[model samples]
Target: MSESAGQPASVALFGTSADPPTLGHRSLLEGLSRRYPLVRTWASDNPFKSHGAPLAMRAALLEAVVEGLESPNLRVDQSLSSPRALDTLERAARQWPEAELVFVVGSDLLPQIQRWYATDEILRRCRLAVVPRLGWPLDSLQIEQLNRRGGRVEVLPLQIPATASSAIRRHPDPQLVPPELWPVLLEQNLYGLRSCLASRPPLR
Candidate 1:
């Protein structure tokens, strides 16, 4: 965990488009739990990207991951899900009125944060914590832009796996996500998982 200049934030808000909630998501939640007193996550509908599963199922998958972890500090709160991050932030503010909110995001989103709705207001309201992704390196220029826009950015020292939900959607590998999600994925036939299950060889 990277320390920011001021007092530690009271909560870490991690909103994801958890289409299938991969192991990477679980690992992130675990890491956030250890760092923040409270960690809130939700399966969001990204206006920029189309989803393979319904928001309900996606949120359920996230719930499964949170359940498996059994960490008191972490939870999946679907009510916070929103297409616009600013709306989510506002809702969270009302929910945890006295808590200092840290808006958590992946390093891949660093460049795109500037274009989000009410980006300046979001930055003003909460500190930004960017979790490093395997392929996406943090850009100084993007960081400078965020700072110029009144953002307090911190790149957390956490090793998130290389696994990506997009890649899992492209190739539904059971090993890529947590086993807790397998039954739901198979039963629901999500992300063309049935074909992948059939193609796998029997266990030795």
Candidate 2:
């Protein structure tokens, strides 16, 4: 969508499944908002993948996570499906012709990005802002390969990396989520961990 009149254009695209967006996901988006004048966060609706919640439900959960924090320049687009990253970037480019596009991803997902569909094209269209995650080696050979192609990638140095969706899902305490976001999580029914968090009990 073209920026109306004098409005500034979006500069980045944050893409994820966002099965049920967690606090860490919100923090990452907030960090990007600080650096980019216009950032559009989006989630996927992949028919092939088994999502924790239905596509509509996932979208609503993300909407709740970002509610009241919306800005004229910051937008959340839920209309798109699981288009190839390159295709999504192209659409974003068409929508905001003057803006540069950056794709935001976590470090854990960065190393395997080469395996993504049309990854090289995606890289050519937008630079990557890789957020670091705990326990994932930042110095792996795969990272070396990415660095070799580093001209298109920038690693974001996040101050705190301890919080993760997996950790939150695995936490024995059902009360681990902060009060402000508890309703959002519970509303989405994402706290169930029977399959992924085998050792942890399901939230009551």
Candidate 3:
């Protein structure tokens, strides 16, 4: 683990599968980088989901995206060993003992966070910074439940482009991805819109 020189007192780690990171992912990181002293984006190797591409391939795709941005604060972690959410958080905490670890995630994942392995311990280590997702209702019941369980979650209302990786993967037009990122997508060999649309069912 490498640390950025002259980093702020508070650093955040954004971890995800990032099979093929979308514009929303980029927006969240870019936003957080401005607020925090240091921000590192990590792509985990998940054993649960069937990935569209291999771990190395996905990491390379993320690297391409980061390279295009030319942001020194942004980084891609390519850890081969797939650890659970808690384990990854613990490692980050140890790596940056001086900086407070803020875990960045989407609101859609909040409902299921309790089911994550050692979730209580995970919360103890880092505060969660949630970005709102389209179609996911962050209601009172959910908020109460999260608070009742000692969750240190902070909700941020960010109006991100309503484009999910799954939606792009299943859509008829590959142009669903922003025109600026078309070259990256093509270089990464992500299924074009027509190919993806023909290959999978419509987004629900």
Candidate 4:
């Protein structure tokens, strides 16, 4: 979105399912927050995947990861809303009326960004900071098309050599998440473990 001539933009958003908050996300938040004034990390719902952990716990995990890093610019919101990016931008606008919103996302999402609800309106609502995922690097031609169509998207260079949350769910690892909060994930039994623990009781 085009910023007003004299207005200042301060708030940026990072929305994620954060099933268990991956190490790559940790890196992205650190790098992005350094550039933006406020980077709000949201634990949003995803219609495609059945979330293993409850919204409250997912948010807690995100907060724990951020807190472990001691990043002052990052904030976590657990509130449930429409899975669409457009809706999140609208909600952010209503809450931070004067704040210029920028949506931070992974590169894998760019190819399908246009398919999102009210894609045009979403572009008009906020700027985009796209992170280059391992397998989903930015396509030059695709970017060109977006720019030509009035979408303001910037490709970020930060890369995290970690796998997706699903992998962590199937095989929990401290390296994939904040070292300090490893125990929490293990003790709580999130993601893939949920199926195993469904008929069992919590660990003592």
Candidate 5:
């Protein structure tokens, strides 16, 4: 978010519920790492959403997910709190003052940016990196409007299936989420399910 002429500008931030970090999330991180030198990822409880699994469980799963990936730029930041983009950006300012901040979001959240809490503050804080969602198209006109409102938006070159954590909670689909984390989900008995498939003991 630093506008100073000489400030370093290579860090990007992606925050999630970390409840069932999906396949699309993996794609987003992969694309982000290719462009940014450092990608900071964090997980928190979304107060707007329904009840979620324990943060510890979600954070552990997120750690495992990152471990399975090959992106060296990706860093799991489990401590980012308040679950607000503005809050996280402020935290970044205190921790890494020279690093420019970019908030990575899904296309579904693009148009809703201005309507979010402290929208004007968020617009002033950082640029946005938006990931595409299947069946949900982004509007160039809308992006233009956001730009006019003093927001910088960058779209990542990735199209991923739109499978949300809510959908996964209702129906766990192995293909919709990261394959490597499937067994971890199974071992945790998450999403209020006790399926025999998810009950098997973890492989030795």
Candidate 6:
């Protein structure tokens, strides 16, 4: 993902389950914003997994996290959310016609990319950028497999915390997510989070 003269600005397209956006999400967005001219993210549903929360609620939470970041380069665009990566790419193509789009994903999801719908076509349209998770290592074999399938991938040099939404769902830790979302988590009783914050004073 190098820039050349007269080349359009590169934009990162990041979509996540964001069941409740966490500190890890904030770190990823901040890292991406520093590297790309524009970073667009949204809360989405994974076709292969069951969601604990509704899409609208998840999107709202992600939007709130993005707002807290206050990065001029970062944005939460719910319109770009889609279960299929191909559809999301198409939406981004239409929205940022002049910019080069880099479809972002985590290393933990590398194995599943090969199984996505129109995998080759999605790879063809955008540069695939994989951010290495703390526990998930970038596998050369997987990268080779994707390359063989007409995919162009770049492993981003960004280190985010080893936080996961799944862990928060199971344990309901207030420390895992941003403070701005504490009230929502309690009010909505999401992820059994009420008990976790019961001892603390209410958030305004």
Instruction: Report every candidate's CA lDDT.
Output: 0.88, 0.65, 0.68, 0.75, 0.75, 0.88
Residue runs of model 1 more than 4 Å from their true location after superposition: 1-9, 201-204
Candidate 1: the clashing residue pairs are: none
Candidate 6 RMSD to the real structure: 2.9
Residue pairs in candidate 3 whose N, alpha carbon or C atoms collide under 3 angstroms: 174-193
The residue-by-residue lDDT of candidate 5 on 70-186, one tens digit each, is 788787887665667788888887777777688888887777777788877887888877887876688898788788888898888876656677777777655566767766676
TM-score list, all predictions: 0.92, 0.76, 0.81, 0.83, 0.84, 0.92
Number of clashing pairs per prediction, in order: 0, 1, 1, 0, 1, 0
List model 4 lDDT by residue over 25-59, tens digit each: 78888887788767788787788788878877887
- Across residues 52-113, which tens digit of lDDT does each residue of candidate 1 receive? 99999999889989999999978899888898888888999888777789999999999898
Candidate 3 per-residue lDDT over residues 62-149, each given as its tens digit: 6666666667877776552245877777677666766778887787887777888887787778788888888876765765676677
Q: Candidate 3 vs candidate 5: which has greater TM-score? A: 5
Q: Give the TM-score of candidate 5.
A: 0.84
- Decide which is better by lDDT, 3 or 5: 5
Candidate 2 residue-wise lDDT at 174: 42
Model number with the top TM-score: 1
Which candidate do you rate higher for lDDT, 2 or 3? Answer: 3
**Comparing 2 and 4 on lDDT, the stronger one:** 4
Error of 1 at 93 (Å): 0.8
Cα RMSDs of all predictions?
4.0, 4.9, 5.2, 5.1, 3.7, 2.9
Report the CA-based lDDT of candidate 1 relative to the real structure: 0.88
Error of 6 at 174 (Å): 1.0
Query: Candidate 5: lDDT over CA atoms?
Result: 0.75
TM-score, ranked from best to worst: 1, 6, 5, 4, 3, 2
Supply candidate 4's per-residue lDDT for 78: 51
What 10-residue stretch in candidate 1 is worst by lDDT? 1-10
